[model samples]
Target: MELGYIVSGLFVGFVVGLTGVGGGSLMTPILIFGFGLSPLRAVGTDLLFAALTKIGGVWSHWHHHTIQWHIVGFLALGSIPSTLITLQILKTFQYHDQQLTYVINLILGIALILTALALSLKGWLINTIKANNSSKVVLIIRHLRSNQDFIMISTIVTGWVLGFIVTMSSIGAGALGSVALLYLYPNLYMNQLAATDIAHAVPLTIIAGLGHWHLGSVDTHILFNLLLGSLPGVFLGSRLSISIPDRAIQITLSTLLMLIGIKFIL
Candidate 1:
């Protein structure tokens, strides 16, 4: 077991726990640039790493009664099928082709930028919605609150977009999904919203990881090393979240992600 890989996992898991963002937004890039792994292997290994780490979150959140099963179901309705289709398309691309690597890196870079922006601007966006009672999306959500069918359809559509982005880059299921859900169900407790998003991410990532494994993209050794460190790291970070002010950490993370995004794109 590489101690360095374990350390990488530990740091990423801790950050994810502290911020409630997906590890893929950090982990995949670390593997590629920090650990000198290929982009494909980094993405594949991080997917499984993310799924395993979140299982612990789900279990804890379940005990706390934070997960909203109906919302999770609605998101899964769109995500699972979209994930399958994305994997099939990914498989059609030639393995290890220079063009393929470029495309993956480009997508990964773009996804990272998007996630960073989402994280950095989320509070502002939410506040804007609260301030502008006439905002179109906010008004639509309010109107649809009583219309279960419309709400369900909207949630599924959100999930579909999440599924496609996540399978392609493993970046959106946390930051993007939570923000979208916050818009849809603004009345839910923040803890419940985070828990529901984490719960839904588990299956989405696991299936996506399995699809990558099927295509022989996964590195079991890397996955195992990361899991070894992440499990305990997540536990420790969750404990610390109660005391730490996350805004500072989030700002630091956003800066790092922006730099990384630019690096990958360049």
Candidate 2:
């Protein structure tokens, strides 16, 4: 069972490296459906897994000077408070395992579906935002680009929403965060956007993960095995990413995630 957990982590880490998606999005679902863990436990365990795994990314990005600290601060300002509120809500239902499981499943299913859609539409969204046209979407994007205050406020609001969803489902801090940042800060480089998203996500996941631990949902043994396999897996996958076309991988992954989401919902 421990070996199985390690293999699962390796596979998930590989996919994450190839697609730049968050580990929680893939790992939590695998823990639930594949390993027969309860949804609450899966989410809690994966949150900690994500926080630990992403520390390396945060360090690398910091050294490269790609991270935007101010953006991370803005996101944290909203997410930290929202995460605390969410944790309190979870605490209220800690003893009602069945009900909490149902809630987590429902939210996780929705989050996965939304994540699939975000991955599928990412290219179109970027193109639409960049295109000089009279389309309503383009117009709104342009307006957002021109307004600094609106952008900042929107980032905070986005973070607030991400906090709640990520705490509940452990699935939105990567794909959704990147997409929202791209929309709000179109002029920023992709690396900078990714760096800022990851920097924000680390602390958010840490807080959420610790809250879940207090709720007694985390499995430290499984987390340790997963990390052992995932580190090397990420390295290998990143090396191979240069050889494979990411679009094809993203499309296939999106379809699979959508189906998984539907399965969970049903």
Candidate 3:
């Protein structure tokens, strides 16, 4: 049992539970920079870690009747297959290939920066959308409401983009997904939006994580350690989420991610 890894998991899981950001945004970088794991190993281990950690959230959200299954199905339609395809492509590349690792790190860095920006801008974006009910964006939303086909097609396309990014970096299924859903389902209750995102992420992460496992990138030992600490941490954090002032947390997290992102890019 690696004590440091367990502690790291506890911190990351607690943050995820409180903020609803994907664990990968924190855990993957922690593994790489904090623990000195290779980029591929960090991403692979974080994928499975995220998958298992989110299962409990699914049940809790389901019990509260918060999930939007139709949306989740639409997301899965594109995400699942894209994850598999991305995994297969990674398998063909030698794991130790410097170029492959560099590419993964590059993608991971960009994803982190985007996730931070998304987090920082989320409240403003949502408020802007809500405030401008008569704006052109509102016109687009109204059109989407009337056009189910276009909405479905757009949802699938978003899933495809998320799947590809998550497969490579174990990020995006939460922060980026939430931003997308906020635009796609403008009227969705914020709590329901969060629950739906969590529900969709479970299967996507599990499938993508298992694919990484098959390719020998996953570290079972590290995964176990993370789970051991994270399960309890998540429960505790979630219980406290309602009382915590989240804007401060989001800003702090976003700043940290930006620094990490810049470091990775360099």
The TM-score values for the models, in the order shown, are 0.91, 0.98, 0.94
The local distance difference test score of each candidate is: 0.86, 0.91, 0.89
Lowest lDDT sum, 10 consecutive residues, model 3, at 137-146
Writing each residue's lDDT as its tens digit, candidate 1 over 13-39 gives 788767777489999998988988877
Q: In terms of lDDT, which candidate is strongest?
A: 2
Clashes of each: 0, 0, 0
C-alpha lDDT of residue 215 in model 3: 85
Model 2 lDDT, residue 101, Cα = 85
Please identify which of the two predictions, 1 or 2, would achieve the higher TM-score against the true structure: 2
Query: Which residue runs does candidate 3 get wrong by more than 4 Å?
Result: none
- Writing each residue's lDDT as its tens digit, candidate 3 over 130-200 gives 77568887676676767878889989998999999999999999999999999888889998998999999
> Residue 64 error for model 3, in Å?
2.3
